[model samples]
Target chain A: MNEALLAELRAALTPARVRTGATELGLYRRDASNIEGSAGVVCFPRTTEEVQACVRACVRHEVPFVPRGSGTGLAGGATPLDHAVVIALTKMDRVLSVDAVNRSAWVEPGVLNLDLTRQVAHLGLHFAPDPSSQQSCSIGGNVANNSGGPHCLADGVTTSHILAAEVVLTDGSVVVLGSEAWETHGLDLRGAFVGSEGMFGIATKLCVRLTQNAPAVTTMLMDFESVDAGAHTVSAIIADGMVPAALEMMDQLCIQAVEAYIHAGLPTDAAAVLLVEVAGLPHGVAADAARIVEIGTAHGARSVRIAQDEAERALLWKGRKTAFGAIARIKPNYYLHDTVVPRRALPDVLRQVYEVVERHDLLVLNVFHAGDGNLHPLLVFDKREPGVMARVHAAGEEIVRISVEAGGVLSGEHGIGLEKRDYMPLMFAPADLAAQAAVRRAFDPTGLANPSKVLPSPAGCGDLQHVPEGAWV
Target chain B: MIDLLAFAAEVGDAEPVTITGLGTRGGAVPDVRVVRAPAGIDWVQADEMTVCCGAGTPVDELVTELAAYRQTVALPAGGTVGGALAVGRADARQLGWGPVRDALLQARYVSAAGEVVKAGGPTVKNVSGFDVCRLLVGSHGTLGFIGEVILRTRPLARHSQWFHRADVHDPSDVFTTLYRPVSVLWNGSAVWVLLEGHPDDVAEQAAVASLVACEGPPALPTGSRRLVPPAQVPLLTGGFVAELGVGVVHHAEASDAAVRPERAQVLDHTVRQALDPSGRLNPGR
Candidate 1:
């Protein structure tokens, strides 16, 4: 690290907020993606002004920087680069204000996703984007990923709920994109910025839309003899014009793992299970739930279990959210692939996913947002086994290719950070990639903000670099 | 279309180029050459609740075509598909549906340098890139010309309207009490509520609303302006219509207030330059 640059950073922010010790740098190096990278230093900014000051110091020193929230991103989006500074925004967690009339709240980027819902639950309103890691992930991270959850099937993603953001640009300039109003004139820069994966700049504050709590909610779990049956049921429910608040699916492997770990009452004998929830007025919710149950039964559901109370409902969701973590009981390491296909193509895609993994001699478990056809196929492997990692990577790539071939996307919620950066070409052509790079250059002309992520480093594209092998899991 | 691309490439380094679609939003550019949509390119294709159409297709014609499938775009009646996407406005029934941008599943457009670029795909849920499909929406033709768009459509709602004359202050209560109204419009002196859904559901919701409202002499108000934040609806002195659930408001009279684009940072300008290096497309709009 440059001593002069360190001094400048220390001067801009208090010495207590700036840390250069190896221990501190190590703590900020890795995220939930399990990818590790080295950092020059980690600075925790307590306010937007402090964040701006830290950015300015990096700009003046010509040092690359990465802004991070809770570091819960699964895509290594918050991973730091070697010789770069990690500006962690954890200390800036605070809800600035809540406008119940407008059904919106102003909060710092570091505010945890679920904390916002807890704060406004008393007013009969809540934030709708409930990612599996909502308890630990920051709103800023959610915005960075445009995070989606099961409820996103009906409520939309994080970008849909975000009203505006106060962002600190690369040169340390502060600009507000979007507004508290429902709509804004000019370019929808806020829409562009939300899912940029921190390449553009750091969002200091976010004005997020809040949704009213439904007067009634019905949660149910249905078991099927085969994955195709469950998938068909999902398509049938949607085709019937019933939009459930949340619809998720877990395969036999995922169900066995969750049942073994938490005893969530999942049927161990079932080939697949669909967890469905509907929310609205009492009559509407009841009607929708009945219709969903009818459809599931028609599609060969072995059994349909409706939650008798909120506690049971919570327990059911706990099983679904912890399905990823429960996979730990099966394999020491797993690479979760996020992709989406048309609802009608779910069955065909699942078969292809199974074939790819089977050919590789890998055990892959399926748990995903069924309503939106966002599949999370977890490839389970033991890294200690010789050549297992290579097989996992190949299978993961095949799944992505197949999903895109089925008219889906490279990613659904987890962003195209270091993990999927090179695979972007599978979904986009050279000209499309160049257009996106232009957008990135428009924001970070210096290429000093979260470099080597999102768009690939095309030739002569400024100082953009590739994610080093050290940054991979 | 190939000729247009060739022309654009020929003039890549010259002044910015303007793209015109049906010439609906405004007349021809003052000083720039306008590239109109090619002949015989206006077409619409619908499949499984999704519609893909050329940018030059008029919104009215597209709506009529989608009506055969009992589907529709959540955009107003006028303007071309490209123009509607360029402006990116949400209709009065936004509460039941969504904004125009949300309906955009995929798009293909020509950059100022004549490179045909595509973002997103023909899928309902996609998070591939930065969602360039949405980024292009409401771009006001500054970035590039929207050549084609694929949109997710919704089943047309069975429409019904109910009007009640009441001097209600702070109409937020109606949103809290009513159940899933398609639109709640306040015309200054009275409120006009539109409901659309299954006949039984709509009638039930309307009855519940009517119980709280006392019928009176009808009053008509004109020159309404739309506002977004429901909290700001009470602040507007004139009569306005508030889509209670959607948090959109329409005032009785138009206001000259404008959000200054100059407030945007250097990044926005940089993006504009990258997409239209020659500053040719809707320059300085």
Candidate 2:
């Protein structure tokens, strides 16, 4: 933890690679969640050996270290809570190998989300797990959060896309978790590592599944008179035995904010908007689009629009993808939270969420992946206003409660970062949390990797961050 | 009882008992207890698309069903809804589909007492886990057990298709596309392009596949397997292609597909996870 030790670490990497200044340390202290802390020193390790060396140095010095990727995470997952060393992996970006015929990629975790696709474009293969921030987020962050995006409705979350990973455990021991060669000889330690929210160790390299680009694609944007109708449309489509690539829903508040910010021409008059996308054979694509139009009209769609070309598709998606930034532009501050439920219960959950937000006297912008039941309900607030941040937190907590009550979970993709750490008990029992914690302990016994995040403090065991409905029931 | 966890014997035909690997999936279970084999169970073939394992095995230890293949149970999402015929929970179209079961071609296991049994050889579809050998597929622990499972491997599909158009001025366009597909019986979810066949056939399809927002015709990040027709070119391509001209597809998406010790264990574990409180096998712990 001293400068001499830090200097020794700096000698391992380029001197310019290590950052120890106040401004740089401040920047590395938190992720998008804005949690505050300080790191003794931050080093960008470019190779697995350097990472091992950093871990050995930390072990030798008895200092804790946190491995960081792109800081686009909402959970403060990459935030440094203690005076630990931050081993950032952005410099290690490399697409090591692509087995085109096999449909998989071996990459260093620092590789950007979209870079893998760029590298594999020639082989008729592409990595499928895409978070909205794919352009900026690192694959490491995606692996840590088990991030899910719109396409996940059909493809699945990050855990599904990760076939194998090479991790550097906290003890400076370089042990491979999953196998690229196929089949581990013993217990599947890989399943427990994903979505551990950086509590286990650093994912240095990943073997991820890349998908074939569909031959044809069709995107649609539709407006409904009510969010309920929009929600029902998603279930109706699925029940009809059709699974679209992506089905996203946004309420009027979200639409208005996004439209105002981007001039993307989102319909402000409708109560909600559903963005639906389908892909396949040319005939199948056209047929599916026609059926969706039929369903929308029957369900009382106010209006619907289809993108005519790639430009139109970009325009249509701009609003949905940059929605967070757009809303942030409108409001000085906002609390973003994610929850997921079974697709069938979306209507009830959305309705309850609206009522709860109203009760708290807060503004809510609802944006969600409708097909998979992953909801990102943003509570807009100005932190400068006293008690507003706390109010937004409470309302946000309520929305997660509603999701859990409806047979959902506290997180679909954002992960149980520092923001939702206190709320972990709302979704899991003490024993269940302990089981997850045990998995973390097995991977990182020292508790040095991004500590004090997902689970609540032991002292506040009885504090209710999320209210279960039965508290009154 | 055959110590199903033991690993030191290779039984000949004259050996009266049957040697079973983890019981196969599909159809009914034969009535017989099993002896265990330990170190004798090992993965013999490890490649990009397929992995072959010894019968007395655990699927959970097989590659963690990672990436695009871990969504629902290979037999639909709810639970072990179907009988324990599906080993890997492979195909989305059919729960407990045929391909994963068919992958178990080579097997060597011991019988109730101490007889080694063998079925299906080392080929992709060695015709081993068939009616005679398949009776041990899902019998909990009854019948001949498994000593090995030879998997049929495949390459991941390269392309997925989303047919909706983008860049529209009016909202009606969205409505038209969303509803038009539903009106007709068109499956609107992303189109999957798992293809296998001659290079000319693949080239023909690739030539027609549009390049608007398409991502690849290149190598993938790792290894993948697909269920493709032998004669048709897949719209998308992947890495490490392997083709076995069989009529089976594995449901790699199932949570239990990569973890089932045996098809029979699927039922017992799920029921145990749901019904058993206090981790007790006996009633009213």
Candidate 3:
């Protein structure tokens, strides 16, 4: 980074808050993805005003800036490319205010996702979007990715839960998208901004709508003799007119990995397992659970187990959420893909996914949200292996292609960051992509918020961001 | 179903056009040409829980067809699907149905550049690109002429019925006490709660809340609806029917401040201009 820009960043944010050391900058380079980027300098913004100051300085210096939260994103959305200024928002963590009567809360961008639910537990309300990494992922990151969790099957995704956001645009001006009031006017700019991959602006504060706790809950685990049976049960459950709070599936590979790690009593002998949870009134929950179990049994489920208490429910969810971590038992590294296909096309898509993995000579685990058909196929391998990444990339691309061919999308929750930027053309036409570019241009006319992120490279959206002289990708 | 690409050509051939369906809300507008979708009930993916229809499809007709499959989209049935979207109609069941915009999953519309563009996709949850479908909703057709839309559909509740509680001061309390109410409407005097769920669950909630079964939902008087803060619903003097938790009030009289979220005029103008550079889609609606 140039000394002059460093001085300006240091002056705006105290010298202690702005760090340009190689060791510290290395930590800010990449998120959880395999891709890595170099950061020009990093600045810690404690407030929205501080965020605005950082944006203003970046704008004046004509340098691009990336807003980073917990750095838990897997799609590389927070990867600072071309030595962009990294404005870390971790210090702004705070649940600013809670309106219990209205069942809404205003929180700073840096607050942890699960912590918001913990803070508001006493009010009998919780934030709805609970991505598996909710424990460490920041709500700002969730907002940027438009994250979805297991509960999002019934509760909807981050976009549905987020009521409004106070954003600092690329030009250093602040604007509020969406409205706190239910009746909004003009355009749904907030909806457009939610999953922009931080290319539009930075959300300083977010007003998230909290969902009321159901009167009753039940979590059940059903083991099937085959992946076909498990997928069949998922279709039957939804076809029966009851959307379970969550319906998750784990193939034999995932079951073995999870059982080895958590020992949550997952049936390793079964070919597949379905974790179905329902929440509502006591009678409704009971009815829904009974119907789901009946559907599972009819679909060739071998055995069914219901969580006896809250502890057991947590145990079942722990097994599901930690499925990714358990992949280390089979391989040292994994490349996960998020794609959604039609519910009925699950079997075909999985068959193709397995075929692709087998052809590429890689190990993959199928554990994903079955209710919504969002497949998270983990390609497990050792990165140290010679030419393993090439095979992983090939299989990953094929899975996405198959999913999109089955009337699916490029991404369901994990957004299209650097990983899927080039694949956007597969799903969208040149005109469709141009409209998206128009949206980004509407927010950041100079294309300097977080360039080369969502829209593919040849979208004709020019960027004025000054790439450093020697920064390499 | 309407061929949206050819429809875009039609829209492009006739520049500066006005498009609407039924012309119910504000009557017809004189223009170069008026257009409508030539399709209705294009497809209903019951397994995927999504329904696609043309812009000219009648909302009630689409609802009836979806109901046969035990599924329904959260769209108001008073007008055509496109008209309801262009006018951004709010449903009485919004308290539980969620925002109207959330129901739209994918939309195909004609852009200002005289081409067909698709936003979002067939899936219920997608983050591939910008949510231009959402921006098209409630836009009053200034941005583009919507051709067809695919909406996320939910199961039709089994036992949905309305009950009324009289002499209610603050509807927010009742809103907090109920469990997954379909809708809660307050017409200045009585609070009507529409509970939809299993028969036993709805009955128990109704008994617990001490509500009396009413014939139907509260009716809104002849006027435009205003969106007040949920907390401010109780402070309204009178002459308004408020959706308790949803923060929409149907005032008996239309006031000047009637839910026009044009506070940030510059940003709104910039976003509008981004998609409609020629400013010819639905000029000066």
Candidate 4:
């Protein structure tokens, strides 16, 4: 059966674009995640018509197909379980059109997030969502994951930025889910299609909403004696009626590693540091910057320093987004958990996160968009260590539980893919999950689309999954 | 307290149900077992900048409550929160704020199966699963019975002023001249600009645009709302008030032209089938 499906896929899209060899399948089995799955065949499709053909071929062969973009997802969303067909979209990269008058652009799904922003910079507008992997991550992946970054605190996530999407449904039929106009009548399938983690379908062409650049931008760094102090300062800034363009926090462990990697001198001794940015008109930005500094000082900040020039501002952001890359300096592997709690609960959540890490005997780094109360607690450890993976998973579960208990969701942006599928029950009741499953079935009734990624095993009859014992199972 | 289960029970065994808010949207009330979502504010998280309210809560009331905390939600005036959401209306401030969907953080609704289901989190950034919350925003109450909602709030601007400019060759020129404007509205003959920011900032942009201070936004003759491509809004002709940069125009009188089609797409039929297979929710919505 597998051989027959491979032959059909190779026929649908010339053999040069279809690969069933063991080596190619090995590379397509997993995303940036640690867990590994199986891939039956990998097809590189370059156009919307080609993508539709691939889906049609997979459906006829009765094989599950997963849409992949750069494979930068950390939650194993691109992992093709059940020997699924991998429709890699890296070759579809292109900026198709730009409507500068309406502040909207049409780009292929494979266009990198940062590349889209850079391509439209001359027009005085840029794409909003900036995932940490923006340099390499595709807009298709951002659409799939509903990705968010530090700037999402001020701007909405990918869903709000995407005005429309041309999606190939599971039945191999192409449909335009939204429109270029500000308002689209009828059910918002476009909103439902995005962030489905490939469960609904694949987005081929995207009409992305471009954000106008602010006239003034100010980036500031504030150091605190302790993580608690830094957490409180975040709350104080928000309480002072200021939502900056971006507000990020980093612990000492993260500070040390990032400084070592970039040599930017990021207060290696301070227990916590904040990187805050506010941008708007010059007069408003000045007032916002001054108020943020005042709030930081009121919360026992050691010093609040403002970046004098654009170069300094860019360097400060570089130190923040390069945080994951700095993990290699401390440990060979890192298991990160993305959860969000109320800003007032940040200090307590951080304290519990530290306790859990210590009890598990793991080194950790903390860096995340603190303004939104999102937490990215990285449990750094060596995988070669016996029984270390088990402890890491256990500690991760505990962190998620505490965040939920503190009126938080399971994830802020990474999504409930393979990483937190089981924990979904902790946040949603049975009916809620059923409703989500029904929505999934609405778009992909056959369930030939990426299966067992977002929903837990046996969400409903429509989903096809070979239920395993655990994450690696 | 609102009993979502009760609403679901009322929808027992696939009986058609229609949601009704205050009579603010007066025309012809659908004849059915009308179910009104809960009314009044549930809680206000001032620090978190979020507010939870029953869907039927009056917009003016919610605005007043949020004003106490010096926060605001972008909702059209003179309607229930649910009424504004049912028709998918957004205030003109969306020029500065984003789409109304961005503020709708969570929703609790009743499925056709008499099941109480919820989507989204009260938190600002949530991507744990499919965004059913936003999907329900403009569904016209066809999918489910929207009971309650959680909306993100923003700090009230320090200063707000409305200005008018006449003989404006184009609204685009007026929009480009302002550094950061809350809204720019244009009728057939005149343009209106609303600026919200620090007094100095608003004053600076007003001077740059050379707009005369006005008491309020210019009102146009009442008519059906028309939606066109944002770029094509300039082509629209009539006694109407059009939101600049946004493609919505309130025309002077009803037009025979149909803006949206009546045919439902495959996904629409599929979602309607999946959620309300028995056609229990507002039919033909």
Measured as a fraction from 0 to 1, the native contacts recovered by model 3 come to 0.74
lDDT of 1: 0.79
- Model 2 C-alpha lDDT per residue in residues A114-135, reported as the tens digit of each score: 8888888886667777788899
Estimate, for each residue in A320-393, the C-alpha lDDT of model 4 and write its tens digit.
99999998988998887889999989999999999998998988899999999999998899989999988987
Q: Which prediction has the highest DockQ against the true structure?
A: 3
Ranking according to lDDT, highest score first = 3, 4, 1, 2
Which parts of model 4 are misplaced by more than 4 Å? A459-473, B1-3, B10-14, B26-29, B256-264
User: Model 4 - which docking category?
Assistant: medium
Chain B TM-score, candidates in order: 0.82, 0.36, 0.94, 0.92
First chain TM-score for all predictions: 0.97, 0.94, 0.96, 0.96
Cα TM-score per model: 0.92, 0.67, 0.97, 0.96
| Candidate 1 CAPRI level | medium
> Model 2's DockQ?
0.04
DockQ metric for all predictions: 0.50, 0.04, 0.72, 0.68
Compared with the true structure, the alpha-carbon lDDT of candidate 3 equals 0.85
Better of 3 and 4 by lDDT: 3
Query: Candidate 1, clashing residue pairs?
Result: B16-B279, B16-B280, B17-B280, B188-B239, B223-B252, B224-B251, B225-B250, B225-B251, B226-B250, B227-B249
Please rank every candidate by TM-score, starting with the best.
3, 4, 1, 2
Q: Give the TM-score of candidate 2.
A: 0.67
Query: Considering DockQ, where higher is better, how would the candidates rank from best to worst?
Result: 3, 4, 1, 2
> Quality of candidate 2's docking, in CAPRI categories?
incorrect
